[model samples]
Target: MALDIYPAIDLKEGRAVRLFKGDMQSATIYGEALEFAKMFEDMGAKWLHIVDLDGAFAGIPQNLKCIEEILRTTHLQIQIGGGIRDEERIKLYVDMGVSRIILGSIATKNWEFVKTMARSYPVAVGIDARNGKVATQGWAKESDMYSGALAEKFVGSAVQAIICTDINRDGALSGINISFTQDIASRSGIYTIASGGFASSGELKILDENPYISGVIIGKAFYEGKINLKEAFALFEK
Candidate 1:
């Protein structure tokens, strides 16, 4: 499978931002949402991964306008996560042209809801864990459950993908946790998307060598000039 490159557009206050290790307080603002989305599309990005930081912390979506504008304007297949807890918001965004929805906080607390949605729509679950245990509520609360087995729960749920993040590596741009990422996908038997600490296109060659990894989410790495968009696309492009 081709390694899909996802340009992340994490929304903090209706603008693009990236949080260090999922810390809300450590967010680095990146500017307006629309302009960034168009830039990724122009650079040949196949997918856009958006996280609503406000929504993730507040337990409800707060960046609908920003999300909607990107959906209405871009040709990118976007996967939206954060602050998405109930069905009304899910239906609303799906109607707004979201290609897929990512279930995070609720996916851990309500497997039935995640299972239900995965069956009816294209959905992925994010297991944001630090040291193998799951973290919820924007990574502010940590759980005792192991990350790999937690993702395994979706085996027969028809889930499109399982996106796992090593919270410690997120936004550090040190590099991706390749072995850790592959373990999650292998144990779950699902298409996995690896996130956190992606540094360069050189790492893409390493990730592409592994079959379990279906995609990689690049954030600070892309914005910081550590990884160039064209070079990244060239490595992963089919």
Candidate 2:
């Protein structure tokens, strides 16, 4: 399968930023959210992965204006997560033209809600794992449920995809956790997108060879210049 590349624009305080190990204090502001979305579109990105940092922490959508601007101005298909705990919020995003809605903390707490949403709208389960366990509340809290076990619950569901992130490597540029991602894909029996710590073409090559991984989220690597998006796209396109 062709690997889809989703250039990530994590929004903190209505600005594009990258957080270290999911830490809010470690946010390194890049620039305006619209500018980043435009840049990714110009670079041939088909999809954009957005996370509302403030929303995730506040349990409410805080960056609606910024998010709406990006959606209106850019043609990039957006799959957004953060602060989406209820159906009303999901409807709000969907009405705004968001292609996919990602349920993170809520997915860990309510599998039935996720399944119900997936049946009606495009939904992706955001499984942020720390130390092989599921992390929630914007990674501020860890749950006893194993990541794979959580993923397994979605098996045979209507979920559009599973976005699995390794909290330890996210924004740290340590590297993509291949085995961990593959395990989620296998357990979920759904298309899985590997997120966090994507830093090189070598890692992309590795993911390209993995049949289970259907996509990846590129964040810090793109912002820090660890990997060239154009070159990575070329490699994948070839």
Candidate 3:
């Protein structure tokens, strides 16, 4: 299968921010949300991945307007996660034209909602983990669930993709945790998207070689200029 490289535009309080290991207090905004999305699209990116950091942490969407602005500004495929707990919010984003909605917290606590959304929309599940175990409540808190087991829960459902992040490696600019991702993908049947610790094009190249890794989300590396989006797209684009 061909791999897709998604440049991430994570918004917090209507601005771009890359949090350290999902820590809300450690966030710092980079730029206005809409402008960033426009720039990313202008860079030849076919898909953009955004997350509502405030909404994910608060358990209530606080960046809906910003999310909407991004959706309106770009014609690229947009996949978003954070604070998408109920069916209505899921419907709202899908109705608002988001290509995919990522289910995180609700994927563990209210799996039925996850299954329902996956069945109804082009839904993706984000399994954020710290040391091999899943974390919830916006990744501020840890959970007892394992990533593989979590993926298994939706095996019979319409879950089309899974985004697995190695939390400890996030925003640290260390490198992509390939072994961890390979483990998750090898154990699951659905498409797996790797996030966190993606520091350079070399790391992405490594993931591109894996048949199970359908996409890679590069956040800090993209914004920090450590990774080039156009080059990545050239290498992975179908």
Give me the displacement of residue 91 in model 1, in angstroms: 0.9
Q: Per-residue lDDT of 119-161 in model 1, one digit per residue for the tens?
A: 8888899989899888999899988788887887887778898
Q: What is the C-alpha lDDT of each candidate?
A: 0.88, 0.92, 0.84
Candidate 3 stretches greater than 4 Å from native: none
Residues 1-238, candidate 2: write the lDDT tens digits. 3889999999987789999999999899999989999999888888999999999999988999998999889898999999999999999999999999999999999999899999999999999999999999999999999999999999999999999999999999988899999999999999999998998766887898899899999999989988889877766763
In candidate 1, stretches whose alpha carbon ends up further than 4 angstroms from where it belongs are none
Best-to-worst order by TM-score is: 2, 1, 3
Model 2 vs. true fold: TM: 0.98
Looking at model 3, report the run of 10 residues with the lowest lDDT sum: 229-238
Supply the global lDDT for candidate 2: 0.92
lDDT of 3 by residue, 60-158 (tens): 778888877777778888999888898888888888898998999999887877887787788998989999899987887888888878877877678
* Shift in Å, residue 109, candidate 2: 0.8
lDDT of 1 at 234: 69
Clashing pairs in 2: none
